[model samples]
Target: MTDQSAPDERGAPRLTTREAAELLGVKPETVYAYVSRGQLSSARAAGGRGSTFDADEVRALARRSGRRDTSPAGSDLAFRTGITLIEGDRCFFRGVDATELARRYSYEEVAEWLWTGELRPGARFTAAAGTLAAARRTVGALPAHSGSTDRLRVAVTAAAATDPLRFDLSPEAVLSSARSLIPTLVGALPTLGDPEEAGGGSLARELWSRLTAEPADAPSLAVLNAALALLIDHDLAASTLAARVAASARAHPYAVVSAGLGVLEGPLHGAASGLAHRMLREAVDRGSAVPVVADHLRTGRRVPGLGHRLYRGEDPRATALFALLEDVPQAAGALAAAREVVGTTARHAPLHANIDLALAVLSVSRGMPADAGETVFAVSRTAGWIAHALEEYGERPLRIRPSGQYTGPRPPQPLPGLRTTP
Candidate 1:
């Protein structure tokens, strides 16, 4: 830690070695351990402040100790077996165009496409509707006004827990997983199982209506369906990677689904929907999104729903999704204003709305609660997870361990009465 004797231009005082070590909960020896390991950089005081270290470097020391740095994932250069591809601008479920599927297909149709890679002729949309209906019923049976994420999480965990066909990771079983998982995690209102009836057309419309209290008009529903199509898959995200890895390990469908959900719980992947919503809300509050973005840039903030690492140009999906939301009035003004701000203030390229931003627009315009948006996204993305898992199941087993560059002392024998430690 550096001294707090003088504040920097940012008006934050520097930290001291002891204070930084204390914050890291490591002894001074371990702090030196980090220094010796070339993990933490230390600098002598320039103006009476003691040796200062980068705050993130100190945190890296903590992460290295725990081995929980599961991020910065490896690229699958050697393996082409675990990925699925969508070839065109038009969204395709399996191989069926999503726009066509959206008009004529049920949610189950989309689930089948995701799991089986084929939208068969005469496919029934609600073959597994009973299971989803049961899951929704289970969620509705929970205590009133509970956090929807928690409730959905618990309900999904339990549904997977109780599933008898979970270990059958066959195409049909994977499709069944999607069908059951989506409606259960979404649909805020209760839905009873209707074995003889499949939720199609108007039934699909009703499900969309039940997802939010806001009236589902043409624009909002179209935008939401488009967002669902857009987010249904991406090329090997961490959560998608986790799902594939689990399937590669020969884990069953439920295990793969659980593993995917677990990855989604991380901030980098699944938590983005909530953050995007918050950013939109901030943009709305400030009246002009450009100034808000300028303020954020001035303060060293990263724009949440703007740029992506993979797509250097504008995200094509964002443009397509925004077009779908053209008539959505609720948050349309804010989105439009933010886009205008992006054009004026951004230096790299004007901001491009990501899937998170699109989902945020759909959720806000439909009046779904802020918390429910993520649940809906998760439910939708189960398609991609199942697809990736299916792709992995066909490949060789995955062993994802990396070599460690050791920096510790050699092993030593213990004396008598010394307790063994892990």
Candidate 2:
């Protein structure tokens, strides 16, 4: 039980190291170890003292020490999901190692496996004629300089408008829409590659054509395909959360994806790879990451893609991508630049390379623009958003809503003008 007497800033009593240690049945130092391993989050105690853990979070962690965390009846904020599990700095999709899935299957296959339990070999997703046409028509009207995600937002809404059965929330209906909508989003982008390859075939190939005019080689396409599979989901990310909220409110599948796209536009989320892309490109141009890394640090900017909040070590996605890039001769310089970036930044703080740096390597080597990574992320993560929507559709409608904790001034205060109306 938590002490109700001393509430922390979050309106609940916070746990000290000793309390958390006792709760977890571990030594005080072990509590800090969990913090470092990203198993738990901590903050400084009041008055700049030692660390403090959220009482509810600590209890939740303790209960889930063996498996995944599950909230009690009243803890509506804690949720349950079976899609993606991030354990021991590794990512798994449906209990299968994600990197392995990325290796053995294509993006469509992995997405299919996530949506359904079965993996269909050589699965192909084709956009509907009407949906693709509508999305293309809508995206064409966007400003010339609009980012890929902006075009995607417009395309999804238009795609939804074209579908008469979009409101059907049944499993089969949602699945059909997902299969069509994903490719439709890719088809909406103006072709930068062979027009023949624009609408279908490999999703990575379709997206590649849109990102740059550079020809897609086997090895490079391999890397891009794996990236899409690897990025399919990451367990209730900001965008996924938004998508789930929309689904909880009984929004249709297209609207659910639109909600996710809204959150993905944030710099800290979808645009992260764009930042890393620019940084890695500058390092490649300079022929050394030292100055570029120095410029970032000297200007008080983070060396983009250097770290992730979830992993205490190298992000597994980065490790997988870097291994694949090693086989591509075109990626050597950009890959080296990425290494130097890690080495340079590690000197001041031991932040390891994250997926953004790996994505930067791909975009820089492939001649894709800075925003190219954002497009890859949006298209890839669409599957995940769909999966979340599917899950939310099974739950009671609007059950995810949380009541606000009122902290504002009491209502009925005198008006600013204090005018007495007759």
Candidate 3:
């Protein structure tokens, strides 16, 4: 082995085979074995004669090998992300409190922050005319009964197919595509009024027209903006993970968003708001919240939008959005219904209102479609999915694959006729 203490031209320390072996408490040959088994990486020596291993990789491998536990059940595959964090009842986006961000910033500003880690107050969010036109045509082709989220999926797929630059995986290109994609997605959905009336403006104003025929009022617009900001990012959520998995395979940003949407359509994720909306509608129709809550509980089913897996207290996003709806005349009935349901649950369980509850209330109060909340969730979460995809693009590909533990029947011996001859 060459000099063990030598540094590469970049001034980083690299260990020789023997030195790495010694540090790992193994023979030099064993060090080569580790490299062969993909446990370590090596580079050529300064003289270009011998191989030198990365000191950090060797040390990490040594530590991993020295651990006694090898069971997969006790270990987990986790991807580190700098996007968002949920601690207790609080949520943060890159160390900034999300509630505060929601209160102070528009959804566009917040989404820009999440994607680029910088707040550009003057940035514009607009899609190409051609892309928007294509998306609208695609949305129009879908069945009239299609949900907002289904239209969104169709739009994204169409957008991906139309954009020749989508395959560009660079951070700058991906972010630009995302900025355009979001607006096009909101614009493509069937609106309740003349499309021209929903002219260029904030995302909330644009989305408001799609969800309702009512004019854009300040209180309702603020609630919509806050909802978008608060929902922008949540660390490694199922949909976000799906986006990251596609990103890990080097899929385009539109395709990454598509992957996330596929997962978000599940009842347990984005569609939770639809169920909550139904619950609130039942309460409104029954003229009593207690009965609805009790009936839902009696059925051995969870109260949709009542509890969150990550929050021990109330969900902060729920609190923030609900606060915005407190005094609106349209929201009064829904607010009362939510209070009754919450009060009833408080007596027996520690369940608290989550973001889905707030979203459901927003939909009911504004007289939006039952699936409007899910649409908001899907659109807002697209920003997060893009952020995660950007992060995953910088990582080594195929790193998210997880090993599975087999717990089924043992492998059977091949039948005489089925066996292949050597």
Q: Pick by TM-score: which candidate is best? A: 2
lDDT string, candidate 1, 241-278, tens digits: 78877887888766777787788866667777777677
Q: Once all C-alphas are superposed, what RMSD does model 2 give against the true structure?
A: 9.6
Error of 3 at 21 (Å): 20
* Model 3 lDDT per residue over 244-329, tens place: 88998899999999999999999999999999999998898788899998998899888888988788888999999889998577
Local accuracy of candidate 2 as per-residue lDDT tens digits, 1-422: 22222467658787888888888776777677667545578887666667888888788677656322232222234456779989799999999999999988999999999998788999999999988988888899988999899999999999999999999999999999999999999989988877876644789888889988888888998999999999999987899999999998899999999999999999999999999999999999989999999999899998899888779999999999999999999999999999999998889999999999999999999999999989999999999999989887887677665566679999899778866999
Off by over 4 Å in 2: 1-75, 415-422
Better of 2 and 3 by lDDT: 2
Off by over 4 Å in 3: 1-76, 194-196, 408-412, 415-422
Ranking by TM-score: 2, 3, 1
Q: Considering lDDT, where higher is better, how would the candidates rank from best to worst?
A: 2, 3, 1
Predictions in order: lDDT: 0.61, 0.87, 0.85
Q: What lDDT is reached at residue 84 by model 1?
A: 40
Question: Which consecutive 10 residues in model 3 have the weakest lDDT in total?
Answer: 67-76
Candidate 1, lDDT over the whole model: 0.61
Return whichever of 1 and 2 wins on TM-score. 2
Cα lDDT of candidate 2 equals 0.87
